[model samples]
Target chain A: MPDRSVAGPLTDPGPSHPCGGTSPRTGEPDGRPATAPGCNGRVTAPPDDCLARNEWICGAYLSSRRDILWGAVLQHLQLTAVSVLIGLVIAVPLALAARRWRWAAGPVLGVTTILYTVPSLAMFSLLLPVYGLSASLVVAGLVLYSLTLLVRNILAGLRAVPEETRQAARGMGYGPVRLLVAVELPLALPAAMAGLRIATVSAVSLVTIGAIVGYGGLGNLIYSGMNTYFKAQVLTASVLCVVIAVAADLLLLLAQRLLTPWTRRQS
Target chain B: MNILSEAWSWLTTSAHWYGQDGIWTRLAQHLVLTVVCLLISCLIALPVALVLGHLGKGGALAVNISNIGRAVPTFAVLVLLLLTPIGRFGEGPTVVALVLFAVPPLLTNAYVGMREVDQDVVRAARGMGMTGRQMLFQVEVPLALPLIMTGVRIAAVQLVATATIAALAGGGGLGRIITAGFNLASTAQVVAGAVLVAAFALIVEGLFELAQRLAPGRVRGGNTG
Candidate 1:
C-alpha cells in the first residue's frame, strides 16, 4: 500500500544501446573504443549499464537476505526458548505425578490429547476471550500444545527404565525423591530431551502462526508477502523457515548426542 | 418460554440449520477436507516410510525430517504459501499446506511400525523362500499394520484440527464460522464451531479405532506393546 511509484523507475530498463560503444569499466555512458575480446572470444566485463543493473539486483538480494535471516532466527529462537521452558516446567511435574499415580495419567493424557487435537488458531481464538490478542495468548496456546509431547515422552522414558535398576536403587536405601532425581531422571533425560526437541521445533513453527494475531515473527514476513502477492518476500521467508527448521533440528540432535553419550555408543 | 424449552428450541433450530446449508454443510466440507488430506498424506508417506524402515540406515534422518515437518505450524505454512505464485491460485495453496502438515505423522508411523516388526519373523519369512516383496506384504506389513493404523489415527486427528487453518486463507470450512465468530465477538458461535470440530474429530477417531480393533490378529497383536 505504501507508494509503489518509486519502484517504477527501478524496473524500467531504459533504452537499449549497442554493447560496444561505451567503456564497460567506467559505467559513465561515455563514448569510447569498445574493449577487445579476450582469448575466450568474449569481453570479461559486462556492459557498464548491465553491471549497474546486476549490482542493483545483488544489493536487493543481500538486503532481503539479511532482513529475513536475522528477523526469522531471532523471532524463532525467542518464541521456542520461552515456550519450551514454560512447557518443561509444567510437563515434568505432571509427568512425574502421572508415573507415580497411574490413575492421574488417564485424565492428564486425555486433557493434553484433546488440547493437542485442537487447531492452533482455534486454540488461540479460545484463549482470545480471556487473554485478548496479546503475546500471552500465543505463549499460553503454544505451551499447552507442547505439553502432550513432553509429558508423554517423559512418562515413556521413566517407564522404559529397567525394573532391575529401580530395585537396585531402592536396595541402596534411596528414597523415592532421591531415586527419581539421582537414578531415574538421568536415564530419562535422553527421552525428555527428545521430547523437548520436538516441542521446541513445534514451538518455532507455530510461532509463525502467531503473526496472524499480530504477534510478529518470521510468519509475519510470510503473511505479508502472501497477502500482497510478493514472490521475493514469500520465497525468502519460506526458504528461511526451512533453513531455520533444519538448523534447529541439527543443533538439537547434536545437543541430544552430547547429553546422552550412551545413545551414541549404543547406536 | 422457560430456559429448558428455549434451549431445546435453539437446539432444534440449530439442527434444522445443520440440515440446510448451515453448520452441517460446513462441518461436512471440513470433515471431507480433513479426511482427504490425511488419507492422501498417509498413502504417500507409507510406502516411502516402509522403504526407509527396511533400509534402517537413515531412520534417524528420516525421523528428524518428519519431526521438523511436524513442528512447522500449519497456519504458518498456509500463510507462507499464500505469497507464492501458487498462492495466486488460492485454495490449492491451502490444500498443499495441509498436506505438508499431515505428512510427518504418517511417515513416522509407517517407518516405526515396520522397523518394530520382529526381526525373527522377517528372517523366518525369508528362510521360507518368500521374496522380499512377498515378505514385506505377507509378513512385515501384516505385523506392522496396527502401528501404522495408530499413526493414521494420529494423523487423522491432527489433520482435522489443522484444517481449520484453511479458513484463514479464505477457504471454506468450519473454521470460517469460528473466525467469523471471533471477528464478531460471538463466543457462542465460536463455541458452536469448536464443538462441531471436536465432535467430528472424535467420530473419525472412533471409526479408526474400530477398524484397528477389527484388523487381523497378525496386524494387531505384537504392536500393542
Candidate 2:
C-alpha cells in the first residue's frame, strides 16, 4: 500500500489537484513546472517547497488543495445528507408500520439490526451488485445502515405517547392521520431527533469509506494522501471530517431543542 | 443468481482455504487484531470508568469526552496514524486506531452502568459493614453487570467490524480478501470476502450475546441462587 500510495497520485495526472496547476484564487501560473521528477521516478511537488519537504502541517498544502478540498467536503456533505434524509423517510413508515401492526415490529427491527451489523466495507460490497460502482451505492448502503437507529428511536418515541393523549385527540374528532401528525409526532420529536443526530454524525464518518469505490468524498482525499504519505493533506482532510461531524450533531441538537421546547423545561 | 453461485463456488473451493492469503489465515488475523485491540481498550477504559463511576465524580467529563470521540471517523484516525511516525511499525497504526475506536463505547457504557446502580443499594451497602472495595467488587459491580455487559458487547462487535481497516493500512485481516478481490475486479471473490467478514461479525455478535446470557447469575445481577 505504501509503495502504491507513492505511485498512485502520480498516475492520475488529471490536474484535479491545483498544486500542479495555476492557483484557482490568483489565476496566475505557478512559475515552477506542474510536476517535478520525484524520488524513484514518482511525480512530486517542485523542489524546496513544503511538499518537497513532506511536512505534516504545511499551510501551502491547504492553499494549493483548496478547490479539491472544497469539492470533497461538498461531496461528503451531499452523501451524508441525502442518505440520512432518505433513511428518515423510509424509517417513518417502518416505525409506523411496526407500531400499527404487531407482527411487523419484530421483522423490521430484526432486518435493520442485521443490516447494522454487516460492517461498512461489507455493506458497500453487498450493495455493489445492486448499485454498481456509483455514488448511489454509498447512499444506499448508508440508508440501510441508518435504518436500525432511526426505526428503533422512532418506534420508541411513538410508543412513549400516552394512550390518554391518543384518546383525547380522537375524542376531539381528529382523524388517525391528524392524531399521528399533530399529537403523536410532536411528542416523538425529541427521540426521533436524537436518532437523527446519531444517524447524521455516523453517516458523516462512514462517507469516507466510499473512497474505495471513488465516491468517498473526503475519504478519497484521505485514502490517496495516505497512499502518497501526504501528511498535510491527510491531517487537514481528517480534521475537516471531524469538524463536519461535530457541526452536524450540534445543528441537530439545536433543532431538537427548538422543536421540543418542552423537553428543555424538564431535567 | 450468477454472482451468488460464483461466490458459493469460491467459498467451497478448498484452494481458497489454504495458503498465505487464505480465508483461514485472514480470519485468524482479523480475530487476533480484534481480540488484542479489545484487551487493550478494556484495560484502559474499564478501570477509569469503574473508578469514576464509583466515586460519582468526573463521570460527566468522561461521558462527554467519549461522545466527542464517537464523532471522529475511524478511517481518518487510521490514515492519520499511518502518515505519522507510528506508520512505520508493523500493524502499530492499525492497533492504535482500533484501540482508540473501541474505548469510547466501553468507557461510556461501563461508566453509565456504574452510575446507574440504584443509589439505595449503595446506601444500604454503606449502612452495612462492607468496605468501599467490597461494595465495588461485590454489590455495586453485580448491580451494574447488565449495562456493563451491554457496553462490552457493543465494543466487541464494533471492533470486529472496524478491524477491517487494517487491510487498507497494509496490515493483515479478512479485509485483504475484499481489497484483493476488489483490485482484481472479481465480483465473486468480493462477494465471497464480504460474506466471510459479515458472517464472522455476526458470529462474534452472537457469541457475545451467548456469553452475556451464560454468565454467572451473580454477574447478571440479583438472580443468584
lDDT of 1 at A99: 94
lDDT of 1 by residue, B1-225 (tens): 243343334335755356443777777778778878877887788888887887675688657666677656676567556544576674667678878867788788788888988898889988999998898888888778887888888888777777776776566677776666655565555555655666677777778878877876656664433
The per-residue C-alpha lDDT of model 2 at residue A29 equals 43
**Candidate topping DockQ:** 2
Candidate 1 lDDT score at position A43: 58
lDDT of 2 by residue, B16-121 (tens): 9999989999999999999999999999999988989999998778788766776888888888887677877878888998888788888898889899888988
Worst 10 residues of 1 chain A by lDDT: A3-12
In the range A199-249, model 2's lDDT, one tens digit per residue, is 998899999888878888888888777665677677888999999999999
Tell me the TM-score of candidate 2's A chain: 0.84
Which consecutive 10 residues in model 1 chain B have the weakest lDDT in total?
Answer: B1-10
lDDT of 2 at A248: 95
Q: Where does model 1 sit among the CAPRI classes? A: acceptable
- Model 2 ranges with Cα > 4 A deviation: A1-47, B216-218, B221-225
